[model samples]
Target: MVTGKMFDMTTPAALLADDTAYAEAVETAVKAAAAYYATGESALDDEAYDRLARAITAYEAEHPERVLPGSPSGKVAGGAAQGDVPHTVAMLSLDNVFSPEEFTTWAASVERRIGRPVAGWSVEPKLDGLAVAARYVDGRLARLITRGDGRAGEDVSHAIGTIVGLPEKLGEPATLEVRGEVLMTTDQFERANTVRTAHGGAPFVNPRNGAAGSLRAKDRPYTVEMTFFCYGALPLPDTAAELADALGESTHSEVLDRVAGLGVHTAADTAVPPRTASGAAEVLERVAEIAGLRAELPFGIDGVVIKADSAADQRDAGSGTRAPRWAIAFKLPAVEKVTTLVSVEWNVGRTGIIAPRAVLEPVRIDGSTVTYATLHNPADITGRDLRIGDHVMVYKAGDVIPRVEAPVAHLRTGAEQPIVFPEVCPQCGSEIDTSEQRWRCVRGRDCRVVASISYAVGRDQLDIEGLGTTRVVQLVDAGLAGDVADLFTLTREQLLSLDRMGETSTDNLLAAIDAAKRQPLARVLAALGVRGTGRSMSRRIARHFATMDRLRAADAAAIEQVEGIGTGKAPVIVEELAELAPLIDKLTVAGVNMTEPGATPPPAEGEEPAPSDAGGPLAGQTVVVTGAMTGSLEKLSRNQVNELVERAGGKSSSSVSKRTALVVAGEKAGSKRAKAEELGIPLMTPAEFAALVADFLDEE
Candidate 1:
């Protein structure tokens, strides 16, 4: 058994100044780490071990010649196994960026090293799972190795059959090595815990811990479902872009596609192509999008990986002693915290769905003071055995809403009371419908009209500038509005009667309400708050039908024809539409547009349009706009550039691929400009783009 202090408490700077002290610290950290991984126990927590490792790394950096031979700085952390299998290539750890500024700084450093701006980048979700390297010989599974210590790892070939998304053989015969993450999904983690509990075993903490335990377990019933998502490969290509090209693929995005085709699972809709000359801004946006989607994903993601998309650029940037210089992990802020569960509150939504919320002692998480967290539903409460007065683990779902993950059962002193679901509506004291796990109020619109109206004016929907929750409540309480459509009917006198309303406020609110009528049909659909439809689904529906009249006339079968709308949702859509007909008619009578804006109509018969430049000024042609712009376009955002391209009847592309027809080079344009010149694609200045747009608008 390991005993005494696991790590030496030495400051990184101080340790770096002394070679002998740093070497001893590294030795202690490595031995302790190995013992912990091999025995499933540790004297030092992850943070302590990480600090020691970091010190070693800092010391090695300052005195590269004096670096110890068997230094832990050169090895993967927590990679200690009973037996070793040599890795074909070292499994390196990534350098991390916790904020947008850091990520931007890292990108700037890369550009400085490459002596040119990066044209494109690949952004992918960073999976919080165990790392594994799978080797295939003659297209058959030859070996599976853990990321034990960079050079060597534990052989887990015996557990290959039990792993999901990892095929024993490829479709074609080829010698390849695939490196990826092994993890258990949230569902699988829960199921495993359930089985373990039934057999009188303690539950696993989280999916990451559960995956590690299941993979290392050498026993019968090796059927604990695990999943693999491939991120890298060997023969060790300089970059993902190089790997793609070597495999006859066009871009890094195509590399992931090919990996998926080879029977490995990769996160869907998570790969974002780089836009803009610097690539930093586009990557940061992608990171934000991924963070927003974290809670909704089946598996867990702690951050996003951003990499330079050009093979030559990556080669020029090269690698550090451990991490690649071309790539960085942009991590989301920590969302988990232990907080006291003061009580449970049942909150009512616009749809009359009554959900349980945990009223907590105020705790700060991810820079926000979270006092209440979502309990999901009554079933979730019971399944997790959450109770009042219990110490609970609170985490932000998708880095957005705070949610109760689980209770710290060991902290319970038998004084905790089981949280009971409300039998009556909190708003109206009406009988609650508990037929499903999610309790709802039978009162429906009568009790939820305020919420419905508030949602209608929300930013994602109508975006009424002056219509806020307070005004919405006042309108509802005064009986001036009963539903969302009733807001349009509200008179100036009624608005003036509200506590805070004046002539200016009343006129602004009315004008905002009037402007909402001209919003796209998709926005109108989203404002209606259909049971299963969101902004994206509503957009799909609007694009499909083109007009509100067509959407209203669409039956269940017709609605189901749209992608993402399955058979189960189709009938619901039909039923909801029928129920909302009266409200739809009211909005139509209020002079709503009833049509999606910017939708392209079908071509006229006997008219053949020219092949290039099809849509607007840039129509039928793929155009790439890069760098900062001058003149009127100077102040426009990067997104505005793409918008201008699309508005000019041209397709806006992020990368200058072979498919590109035109390159709009702005002020200080970089590698993309060079690439455009090399590829013989027509290059235009920002002034030219502005002139082209002006010409198109003039013609219109």
Candidate 2:
């Protein structure tokens, strides 16, 4: 359903010409739909399933005679499921549009069909859950039914007490049918898995699947609660004919309001609520707003549902077999997908930490093709029972790296192979240090000389202008440099002898290396690639200790005195610093600055240091910078902004939390910005952030 073009895709037309390929695609789609609708478990993820369905539809349009009877198009639950219980009215799925252009075209068609422009539009999230109808008799809940095959549904009245937000008895005694979605909240999903596993049940694959299983499940040892969000309501039975007629005539938003009054929870209860928009542009704006909030929502929403608010207009537009002409779902990108774990590659980092990365069969997720996902470590793979050829659920949120959530154990075909842990260092073929969960090369940084040296000269570290990975590799291979310290000792003639090294280039490289020697202790420390220290942590340490001599002299307890360094991490930092003592001595001899500028040392010995100034603008505050810097802050990287935040007397955090004082949101800010807005955290633009830290910027 994603509007963005998928990667590694075979043309739909190409597949249509081959009967074997067409049948295979159809069979795959049909099976996936059957499993998805019946048990809420499917081998194919939403994205893959939707792609197949779309292709089948396109093929059917071109070659009607070749259309298969089991095709998933224009059918509720892909016609894979059915129930005998008849519905008072059909429970239908909405048609989808992937972009504003498609949505505008759909709106135009609807207006043209109705012989007038729509009065208004109501927009709300299209909850990614199973649709169901709850019928209440005299305001007392009587039956719960799944939207099986649209015309009829299965009786799931047994799940009556397990659903939240759907009152057993209405505020007023009135017979009505509330149409809505049944889904588990994010917290509920996690708790459900914990409880299920505790009771010897296999954990549910995802929130949507868990909700579906929970809804129809009977005779289980434990109950996992699901929430019901009312999307529509209609009158049912003979006792509420008048109310039914009124509901039939009422606008969609008005219907939601009426249902809320009857003790049914609706989107109106949350930060993101349904709203009425006057035109297509407003509707699109609301759609974008909902999409922006998707990552922060407590539950999943695959798209935004936009419908004509006028009941009269709805009647004029009429309906199709699958969806109403008056409504359309604006689909967003798929955040999760099921893919095969083809292999696992262990790569050595600059610190010699060997990390396992899962090589997956290319799958499109969140508008990008992902073939590799972070695997944490061999222990994580073993703990999750991940195996080669396993069907793994891949999760990607915003710009965060894709990661394997877990393997879909139930979908395995027994061709899976156990993921073997490396016995030796994969990169340098040396003995591996397996004492820690993350295996490392016994040779440490020496095993990755080029990477270590490249990181040292990076822009956020020593900031040597002419040095890059290619140049670092060249120097390492040519025997001119073996480590970061060697960069400062390089002769001008040696640099000039390298390929493409002109006289101007050689001088620029030399000058850059010379300039790098004067960088503050914080930058120098960051360049050293300490196991637990990045730019921010290095800055904090330098600011706390003021000089390398003081930092090297501090023990774990003394290091813990600095903010954000925990007791457990303090000892690791101490050990890493001890190991790097030789390298530190080498850099010191090379004349790199040994103290951070503008920093005052801690009070001598055991005396308590003077308290920080409470009047400083960002004092005692935690700030997070996200997206891209702009205006005067454009030239600064995220690390530089963090440095500026610290210099301005604030603690910089990468994650947004309840304790976060503010968020500096910039261009294209995604989840963090949404989270800040959701949590009511104050937000400052890059310009505002620049203004707030003007003094620190001037110092830089």
Where is model 1 more than 4 Å wrong at Cα? 1-127, 132-139, 142-155, 164-167, 170-181, 184-205, 217-344, 358-374, 383-417, 458-466, 491-520, 546-550, 585-700
Q: List the global CA lDDT of all models.
A: 0.72, 0.86
Per-residue alpha-carbon lDDT of candidate 2 for residues 467-486, written as tens digits (9 for 90 to 100)? 88888889999999988999
Evaluated with lDDT, which candidate comes out highest? 2
> In every candidate, how many clashes are there?
12, 0
lDDT by residue (1-700, candidate 1, tens digit) is 1111211112232354586788678777877676445432333433355566677877778788987777766445533443478776667678766556667788899999999988688888788787889887767887888887666888888778877878898776656788888888879988877775555454554666567777777873435788888876554333344443565433445556666677766664232222222466666655655654455567877677887877677678988666788888876655566678999988888878898888999986655689999888987777677889988767665345888766766557999987876768998999987887778788765678878888888877887888788888888778888888887888899899889899999999999989888887878998988877876677668756778888888888888877689998898788778878888999999787689766543233476733332356676788898878998777666644665565576666666766799999987675566556645799999888788888543322
Best by TM-score: 2
Return the lDDT, model 2, position 653: 93
The Cα error of candidate 2 at residue 110, in Å, is: 3.2
